[model samples]
Target: MKVFKIVRVLFFISFFSFAQNEDYVKENYNKTETTITMRDGIKLFTVIYAPKDTSKEYPILLQRTPYSCQPYGEDAFRTKIAPNEFLMKEGNIVVYQDVRGRWMSEGVYDNMRAYIPNKKGKQIDEASDTYDSIDWLVKNIPNNNGNVGIWGISYPGFYATYSLLDSHPALKAVSPQASIGDFFFDDFHHNGAYLLSYWRVTPLFGHEKTQPTAKPWFNFPDLGTEDQYQFFLDAGPLSNLDAYYKEDNVFWQQLKDHPNYDDFWKSRGIIQHLKNVKPAVMFVGGFFDAEDLYGPFNSYQAVEKNSSNYNTIVFGPWSHGDWARNSERQSIGNVYFGDSISHTYQKNIETTFFNNFLKNNTQVTVKLPEAYMFDTGLNQWEQYEQWPPKNTEKKSYFLQNNQRLNTHAEKSFTFEEFVSDPKKPVPYSEDIKMVFTPRKYMTDDQRFAARRPDVLVFETPILTEDITMAGPILAKLKVSTTGTDADWVVKVIDVFPSDAADFPETQAYLKMDNYFMMVRSEVMRGRFRNSFSIPEAFIPNEKTAVSIKLQDVNHTFKKGHKIQVQVQSTWFPLIDLNPQTFVPNIFEAKATDFKKQTHRVYNDSSIEFTVLKKK
Candidate 1:
């Protein structure tokens, strides 16, 4: 039921066949199944795939996942076992396990389970489970060199991060790719606003099974319509959706009860506990990853600040778990980046990372840089000595009159006004199809949004020189609303030149000219403007400062391209519509609480960015 399961299977079937055939995997590898007992006497089902040729001892590469370790029997073999074909063909004792309470593993499953520190005997957490598993692997698994490495994407990636803490001596390397650092900021919610687009995926983790099984026990809700925006709008308030989940869904009920960042959510956060990490860590994520952009960046920063363990980060122009695939051409939505981008990372970055630390006979002399980031605009890779390169300077672009984004603020006080109608919310994308959580919308064109009257668009003139931004973006706004509550959505866009040509991979109905490519965007529920734990209502018609932090960017605004900004109240079904009227819990807000409100953005509003200096 993991969110990445479908994409992983599709990628495995298509790419793995080309890289290494199923017959090759069945011929060279031997599969075995066993259950490892934890300190609490709970058994976790594990599958091990080791090379038949035992001439040389190999390192252990493990992936512990809430998603089931499929092809459960000893006779059945996976198409590709290792992280990539390079590692699979080269040979390693690849391991996959069903994390506690999931699949065939015996225990209770907790979403983003909190790390238990300084534990006594029989204390259980993901870290402890990982420790127990590694201990068992090295002792029982034959031909293992006593060196272990862990890697996973999405939910499994979170487990990889967990393994870093209280790690076994044999665990030398760890790669947490698109890992969830905190559910509050990751998949389910963004800045305290619930992501309604992800509603379809609730059944995956919400429902509990009577017993562990290899097949899915929860069923997805069938909306029976492709138009998600209309479906959510017709469904009305969040409370109405309870008809679908009801009391059977544990996670949905928990979400409704804890609308604020109280003890429940604070304890579940893993970022605060990423201290004294032992394993050599490599944090990987996509710049356009719609689901987990906040997780990897914040987790990496936490590790950098707390631990002295060898750590590095890599950001690519991928969406969600795209780096795990072996596609010849890499593209997100209407734009195509480069060919074999994921393959390059697998061969040069991922393969090199594991082999360097896990293999005793490795000849890898070149260590990865502190940061290996991809520039979306340039469509190229760049290495840095450190993240947010120390040479960067802070710059602010002000929202001016005549829809201009300038270096200076307006001389006089002026504001642009727009009426936000909850009944007619703005759609996040032009596409009308339903999705579990739309990934293409991250880099989707914004022409449809800009044309809307509710959305305010501000753009700077065509840049005479290339300007690159390397760090996080701060959207500091001076705004007010007639109603007591509202949600602020900010977007940073890259406007292509008028004469730009479409690439071969461009969408049939889309063009490259004047494409309003969304570089970054974030939303902040006004109620949580002051403190996440304490809800505050905005004074009607009073100008207040609301600052939203958009995720970090390693993008360059080319010489001919224009830097643009868009501000709006609603992002449609992407995020649940906030009732203009202030209410204690938005989850319980009735339909009558929703109201139309006129919002204003003053000219003094500005966006702050870390501008990388020209060297």
Candidate 2:
């Protein structure tokens, strides 16, 4: 029997002794500050925090940020040190520097996407700037133990990843939280789907257009932070994304140049270069994180598989901003965690990883295993040697009942036919406020959407026993749209409680990729559903089989939560409106080109879900 003691939800974790000790390091004024010039002749603004009594040497913790390195910020009010903490203020020195092209740093700020690296006969990159910055910090900073480590969240997180590239030996550990791997795949290009709305919105949202010329840049409404947004009504470079900004944007042009996985995407691709990691690092991500779930997870997996370096992965049920700002206890809707788990994981787990490797010179694997995940259904955290558990069996459930799926015994039924209008795509919700968001309803009451003539819904009856599934989910459907090209958005939803009487609290939605969504896995352009690397026009009304793969999904269907699978021809606003007319590039297709089309799903061994379930 295991005897586990309860840990209070609230507790303090002081990083370094000096931060708490007033006499050790004066938290008041500039203990030390300077701007160092890199070997490339670009000046980097740097600030150094040192102990008041510098009679002895201490380990250094380094952070490189593009978000302006404010020399004297509110962070001073907090103590940096405590035993079992990351910012053990007592260490050698803490360093912060502004990345090139940001803040006071010299060099024209070319967004990271325009990274010009000095590869063999290739353009030079910010990687060298990172290399140069670290090199200068180590040699110049005083009261230094000479040991250094780097860390940053989000964009700075990107800088943190590059710090190790052509890195110095003295560099120790790093933690990249919600960091982006490649702008193409994870950021604007989700599963190869051109996230046009988010892409254009992000640049403006981040004030990227202001660049080096627009000094004292202003912050606008974050894309999703606004109270309400009429995306088309807003007048700006971003509002007319498909019109004014489509091919004109520099990065957009670059992305188009590399359509269909080519050298362009491969250049900034960090996965291949992860080998020979100099620092013991930790990549953090939220399972529900919309921004960069793939960044930390993929980064961790790539490094572990491609190289001999050891790293750790921490995955929790969190959205983009959940892990930090919200109550670590729980967040949005009715999803309440039993405890302040986020708090513990953030302070203890994150700080521990940094301090242990950078300061203590200890191994990270000993304290906790390489991978740790919190399971929502069980309300507990579990440790595993690897992801997708070693012993996972693949399973499948067929689509029937006029596209209805049920465990209460189901039988094959005739295929369904519906006419889809490109102009009036089925909105995901009944309310007009969310008309642009057509996919949200896929997670909600399938009943409302199934009534639509254009949608196909397959549902399973309430389960008698919990059906546990772990790993990615896939949908192999034999589908044919009347038009030459169209989009198909699939969603796997968990219907905890039926809407017949009351709404259930527990629910999760996983959106599938259009052929565009499949770039992360596979692509099924409507013209080539039954074929590959070639285009095949829909024989007007000919029936064909096409496999649609929903990305891997993990969930356990408790005795009550019904499993729902929804299929639609369009996921507007989330995806560009398919013109329903085969064209060279739908992004530029004229309005007149769009047409009303009839789509038919075949049933002769046509549609099935390769789902995983318990024996």
Candidate 3:
């Protein structure tokens, strides 16, 4: 009892120390507000926080965001800055800016503003805006060092990515943490399937502002009931959403305009323009991140293909921005990934990355491994010279008779069929409450989904050995649908033992017995099975190959735990329901376009996993 009391006291002391450090930094720093003008003559609002002690030169860490840098006045300071308390105590000049047309900034706001490659007079893009901002900072901000480093999460992360293109020479290091690479693949849509959960935040992006203001011009509507799934179902059809959003919402109108991966979305993608990146880049993402997983992974690949800069990636067992926020409690949903996993990353990887490049911390050289990824199955961090670790062997898990997953293919020429009804689409979660974002669903238990008649469940025998997957998971299916169009939802799950016991850290409400934890999942619209640019309808009863590339997963199916694969046609309120009819523009589809379809998955269909061999 004495030991327990002593340990509890020490824990609070340690936590207090970190909090005190953050408070001290805030007390010591001076906040100043200024406007930086872009080449197009639009002025952007910026907040600069410099330490009171000018004892030594500090590098500039700038972050540009469409999300307002609140506490507008010069006297008001942010309580915490620089990713975590570690970097804040390191004493760097932290700069935050409201990107053009956001908050106090002046100009017309554009969503994921397309980058203009060859600009004539008065033409501008996000890259040019970034260049101008950095140029202004170096000239105006009275800092000792010329070195500039930029980093951001989510949309701000998008700005960080854009800064890489035509990067300023002064911009030395950049970390696009959970960055959005493409609108079509990342946040809003995945392989042409719209994320219905994002509908809540659409008003935040869609509404136009008459002038730059501190508060939001338009507010997200309160979806009357707590049950969003039922609300969305009652709302009926994607076309009906416009009635609530109205025509004034430019972004809503834009979504209606471009139903396909047309030139508009193509030009907005930063991957194509990521050539010859000069900044020292470290792309960070989460293996379990529900949103923007496509960004960091694809951005890293694009950079590797285009540039030779000191580029690296770090994918932790985290949700969107979990590393920054939930530093002490390292868990997503019910899956506890050990304590201080996020703090370890912030102190060791992130802070070290910035200090090495920005502060020139000579104790450790800035040369890092190509990838520093967390293995969720093993609950350990692994560093590799290359991603998808070259030591992996490709293994295919074929769907066989009696809903089993085996290495050997079943040549019975049989298929599993289920009737998919749009009216009663399978809910993404069993939970009844509403949320702006369904982040926990990324790791939520799938036992509820497996019992659904419309979903196909396949599982491997309780693993005799620990099977670890290291890289991307590809699902290749030979399927036939009764309707002209459909959406394929694939889930990779880890089924706990029937007699499993909950860990001490597990949430009280979560039951460990027969737990089915989702590791990786993806949705692909059937029409885009051929091409995202063109919509192709499925011929009735004709077997077609539909390939779905699930996000990269670093997980282990522990010994005694079963590996389960769930295939379903609908994930309602999470992904927009497919009308299951040949509609050129799904955004404009009528309620009658929605229909019931029988989808068949052949026995020959299989999922390929990149399994890592144990050392």
Report lDDT (CA) for all predictions.
0.90, 0.54, 0.85
Candidate 2, residues 133-166, lDDT tens digits: the string is 6777677766666677776666666777776567
Which candidate tops lDDT?
1
Can you write out model 1's per-residue Cα lDDT over 1-615, one digit (the tens) per residue? 353465344223222333656698889989999999999999999999999999989999999987778877888878778788898889999999989988898888887788888999899999999999999999999999999999988888889988988889989999999998988889889999999987887877887876778777777777889999999999999999988998989999999999999989998888888999878899999999999999899999999999998899999999988887878889998888899999999999998999888884433456899999999999999898989888899999998878999998868999998999999999999888888678889889999999999999999999999999999999999999999999999999999999999988778899999999999999999999999999999999999999999999999999999999999999989999999999999999999999999999999999999999988
Cα lDDT for residue 278, model 1? 78
TM-score of 3: 0.95
Candidate closer to the true structure by TM-score (higher is better), 2 or 3: 3
For all predictions, the C-alpha RMSD in Å is 2.0, 8.6, 5.7
TM-score for each candidate, following the candidate numbering: 0.97, 0.76, 0.95
> Model 3, residue 374: displacement in angstroms?
0.8
Output the better candidate (1/2) by lDDT: 1
* Candidates 1 and 3, the one with greater TM-score: 1
Global CA lDDT computed for model 1:
0.90
Off by over 4 Å in 3: 1-18, 21-23, 361-366, 504-510
